[model samples]
Target chain A: MSEKIVQTSKEKQEETSQQISRQWKLSTSLGIMFLVIFMAITVLNTFAPDFMTFKVIGNFTVTYLYSVLLLYIASWSIVLYYVIKVTTLEGASI
Target chain B: MIEIPTAIGMVVLMVIITMGIAIFARRFGSSAAEFYVANRGITAFQNAISLGGSYMSAASFLGVAGLVWLYGYDGIWYASGFFGGYVVLLLWIAAPLRRFARYTVADFAFGRWHSKSLRMACIVFTLISMMFYVVPQMVGAGDLLGVLLGWDYTFAVVVSGILMTLYVVVGGMRGTTYNQIFLCIVLWSAMFITTILALMHYGWSYNALLGDIGARIEPGIWLDPLNSFALALGLVLGTAGLPHILIQYYTNPSGKAARWATVGVLFIIGTFYMMTPIVGFAGRAILGDAAGKNTVLPLLGQALGGEPLMGIIVGGAFAAIVSTTAALLIACTGAIAHDLYVGLINPEASDRKQVWIAKVSTIAIGLFTIGLGLAFKGYNVAFLVGLAFAITASTFFPMLFMGIWWKDMTDKGALAGLILGGASAILIITTNIMGMHTLQNPSIISVPLAFLAIYFVSKWAGKMPDDIDDIMHQMHSLHSDIK
Candidate 1:
């Protein structure tokens, strides 16, 4: 009976460790994705001046004001998604 | 121009109000922890407002507007980068840093690495960055006084320094936080009203103003890809490493609170930055090139709303300078009293003694900054702030990032990285000051070199600490198991 109890406890520890590793990987990937998207947009606005300067409205350019707004919204969405997912996961575990 | 008597009255009223808040907060700061982190009891919303107030230095208020007025589209790059930095801070540093819950960044470094040398290195870099950061606030104070009350630059710098020192010495972190929140409300109201009035002057047509600005912007000058990228990179990464700003996280109740506060800060700062362009564009169109660059916003206020409105704006500007200067002084005091004196010299010192030492150091730092500010009068505030950011980005950012995430970061590696990164940044900035303008923002090169130094040195010279696994677990864990 004691042997069986020890074996079960070992298995549970392994499972917990695996779950943590998976969460870490997912979180890191999400972070990297956000950074890449942010840097790419910045690069586009910088290198492609004419494209950014394409007049969208009367005086607003594609890259100057509008693109920045889009990037801001996208970044915030990414963060919000991460925050919700992580909090839910922690809640479920608890 | 603003009448001298009105400006003096406005400034005096602001000083009295701030001092009153400090006196009220004096009771909360009886212990070292209370002085440093407000006993870790500040709520997310209040901390967010205070953070916004501290972050929007004179550089943001006067400097960004001036740059926008002078350079048009190229100038908005500063605001874009400054706002984008919070995104990085929220995702990368905020949660883990708060989990550590140390008094200062040096304390964090020492705890993580168990190396006195690394802690000393952090203290040096912290002091350098804080001193450089305070210079711009001093300069802004002098400029505001000169424009408003017609005072000599040196006299203005000295007065501003003394007022800020008094605030930090009396109230410490609690006082600074309350005063910052009050100042931010005043600042935001003034900016909103000014932006509205300026738009009204242009008949509420953003397109008309944009059309004028677009016509004036020289082709290719406004959108140099390399310079723009450099500016953005420096601002975003540099913000991640600022000692004074990072210390604010410790005031939160928990890591989660810190994260939420950053989210709040994002919105608060974004709204303020958005109004800057309107102010800048309007100033350019109405005030023209005749208004001195640093005085554009005040002059624009007078033009749109007359002397009474200008007085309000000047009061807001002084508040911005004082709030930022107080934060910097507090950070400097922490480095001396908590990090050096307590951590290194006398670990057994009582809380009362530590607080006393912090107050003394605050006054000393204030006097030193006053002299530097006087010497650098008429220098561009934004440019000086950029250099401060570069130094911090190259030195502290790499160390902190690696220390928190990478388990293999050895003490030796951290020390090497800090020395190399800091030295390279100073050399490049000094050379730029001496007219070698090729490397204006050293982070573009220095950060990578610092990382490389850490990586190679750790691989060859030393092994990770024995307790690193536990440290890593603590940093990565969702909640504290101890509680």
Candidate 2:
């Protein structure tokens, strides 16, 4: 098998590859958004102790561990789920 | 506490309903997928609910409330740590494990390494960690049943064991997931109603009520900072490595479903966990010393609506225990069945046979847990879960993190880390804190040591593997290429 033959399929492969990477980007973006929320909580807690007592923000942060765990776990779970949905969507497109 | 007749009747009814669900769900197990990962056919919505149920275990139920009732403001760490742990789970673990491992956690362990020895190492560590997790649930069930229904501690263990085993054997993951979903809904409604009632009693001013309750309790116990940090660290880090929670990731039909489920799970778990502290704090203000620490929840409910409400509250706590217990049982059995029995013992076993083996193994483990529960009936629920968290954080967390991200992790290094992690954790549980004596300010001496051992051992294992870059690419690979 010539190297050229392998090289020739690269374009076709890239076509599919581009599609897949887009999904990964979406998942990664969602993941980072969740991290942002968690970081926000940490920042709020560090800078503002009184803020921790506010019912909306403070209540969530005061019970920070639960909110963090639930949010992060759910977010990651969403990413995995998106993988499945994307796979199925691609399969259908094919 | 509830009377004997009511308690026994409640116990019997709960058992019968659970068994019925198990038997009905048996039809879903005709195929291997149904048995193992529920055929990877579980919808994200169903899984999201199930995840919420599984994650919110005895800790969220009895422990948080009890701590709030006992320690006042300081107890919020229980809720905070648990929620925070999910962030670590999202960032470091979860999707990657689900994406890579097709079989079990053991399969993931063996994927990069060529050593059968390393595969066995992962299995043993997982089983040991899960066993620690199980004992507490069993003990909690026994204690709760005994107090609520006046059943002998032994009888409670036996009954709970039998019911758990029967369902796990017949329904497998399908049964476990559905049961978790059912149980979670019941628990959530119960807590919500209780919280609302508690708020209504004091005209719904959280600050006023908290202040009043804070006044009643001893000064330092209600709002200590250091205690919060340690509790937060344990709960936050512990979720990343839990055997059951990680295993649940594998059951998602597709990676997308798993991610979607995470979104729903966050909302459900986030809302419920927040409510736990509220319920606990309310109980503190209302019940006070007239009720024991664990009695805070039930007493408040009873005070709100007398016997009928009390029964419902107790029932909700019981439901919480059952859902988490069932999920743990399934996760532990998967470790034995998929990791050891199928992966190591009979590598060539057909999928059907593998499912059957899992069912049978679940029964055996269920029986074993019952014995441990009876033996440790007097122990505290939070204490047992913390020990579980410690062991898991020590052993599995490092292994999972390093195994996925670090290419240089050798068989010898992993084995050493796991053994050291588990042994040191067990030593801490047994010697530094016997039974449940030191639960209040539990010793976390072993936690840092476990992480340190893995880091140093892996560093010494030598240069990175030749395929390190390839593995990294696989992890960072774009979904479009696979699509």
Candidate 3:
């Protein structure tokens, strides 16, 4: 009898030659953002030390409130976008 | 005004209700599937509430306010980090994890390699990581009872452990889910009422509270951009990799359910985190360091509207600790039952027997955690939590990232990473616990060393598994055109 093939669920591990520079570019952007924020903290700490803690600037502190607000909104948006993208792609193909 | 005994009764009532739900939940989940994962049938709405209950542990409830009370504005970092971390989880592991692992975190790792060794290695890592992690929750439980009801610390530990174990042993996942959902509601309501009263007492204006905070404590520390950034990094990245959070993916009935539940989780967690700072800042303005920093919310209640509101907020604090501890107990027990005995020791164990094993293991782990809490009494709980995160991120993060994306990862490579990363983190933590100056002085050096060890060892092996290309395709599903 001919040799039988044993099929498994996992795909073989091979380097994709598609050469996606986009992933690297995105990573670099993230790194830069981290650096910028880090430097911003240093500068604020040095110059506007009093402003670094939570104080109401009318309704919010420019630093603490802004950072929290941005992080909060960005997190939710990313989750929603990722979920929708995956679900749509899965449905369209499968 | 409410008396102390009345507060104690409400708290006890909440605990009994939690136990009742857990015992009742077991009836529906007669099989292993039902027991471990609520049969993967929990709706996003219910799951989201349970997630809220789990997420807002003693750390969120007490830790944030206390940090704020002491450090002032610097404390918001905890809320930001804890909430934002889920975003990272959504990106890094969420949908794919649900799609890949039909069982445990180890099941996914082992499935990829067809290696029992890899599965066993993961089980050991999970246990080590979770034990240190759960100890802090137990400590928080003890502290909450000792302070609130004037109960002895040991009594609190035993009380919390016995109730949590009863629910988990009898109810399983179904029981845990319902208990968490109920507790989440009670916790949120207590927080809302307390915040409003505190604000009303100190003038119901955010601006007024901020002005008071500004006048009393110098905003010099809060305005620093770089420190804020570092805090953000810890909060976001740390939250993403927490094992309890990662396990939430398994609670979904389908991949679609995970996506929807994430949406619900986002709203719930975002609101909760945002509100924490309010209570923290409000406490600073109204209570004026009455009882202590950590007791900001409790003090604010009593200072603003006398003992009755204090009783309610105190009840909420109990809700927070119970919900979090109960969830951790279930998750850790599930990891043991699913990853250890069934996966490694007995692969063909029946569902009935598996449920029995889970129940027994739940109690065993609970008792051990109680002993740990009593031993580490009054230790810096927040810092201990950070140490747990450092260990988790170091060990599981590398193993998981490589296990999913890199097919060339070998058993030898995995074993090396597991031993190196897990051992290093454990060693550092043990040293810190023993008061070692060099190890505890700076986590930065040790944390990176753990990751570097994983990478270098995996590379030093020098040869990829022959089936590398096939694994890549499975992970990316490149063959399946996403139309």
How well is each residue in B1-483 modelled by candidate 1, as lDDT tens digits? 455566677888999999999999987747888888888788889998999899888778776788789887667778877877777777667777887668899988987888998899999999988877888889888877887778888888999999999999898899999999998888888889999998888799988887776554322455466656666778888898999899988888877778788888887887888888788888898888876667788888889998777888888888889999999998999999899999999998987898888888888888888989988988977667767898888888899888877778899999889999889988887797789776667777888989999998988886676666555544555653211
Cα TM-score per model: 0.92, 0.81, 0.85
User: Where does model 1 exceed 4 Å of error?
Assistant: A1-34, B216-223, B378-383, B481-483
The iRMS of the candidates, in order, is 7.5, 8.3, 7.2
Ranking by DockQ: 3, 1, 2
> Which structure is stronger by lDDT: 1 or 2?
1
Off by over 4 Å in 3: A1-56, B1-3, B215-235, B305-308, B427-447, B462-483
Candidate 3 CA-lDDT value: 0.66
The number of the candidate with the highest DockQ is 3
lDDT of 2 at A61: 34
In candidate 1, the second chain superimposes onto the true chain B with a TM-score of: 0.96
Better of 1 and 2 by DockQ: 1
- What DockQ would candidate 1 receive versus the native complex? 0.20
**Cα-based lDDT at residue B175, candidate 3:** 82
- Index of the highest-TM-score prediction: 1
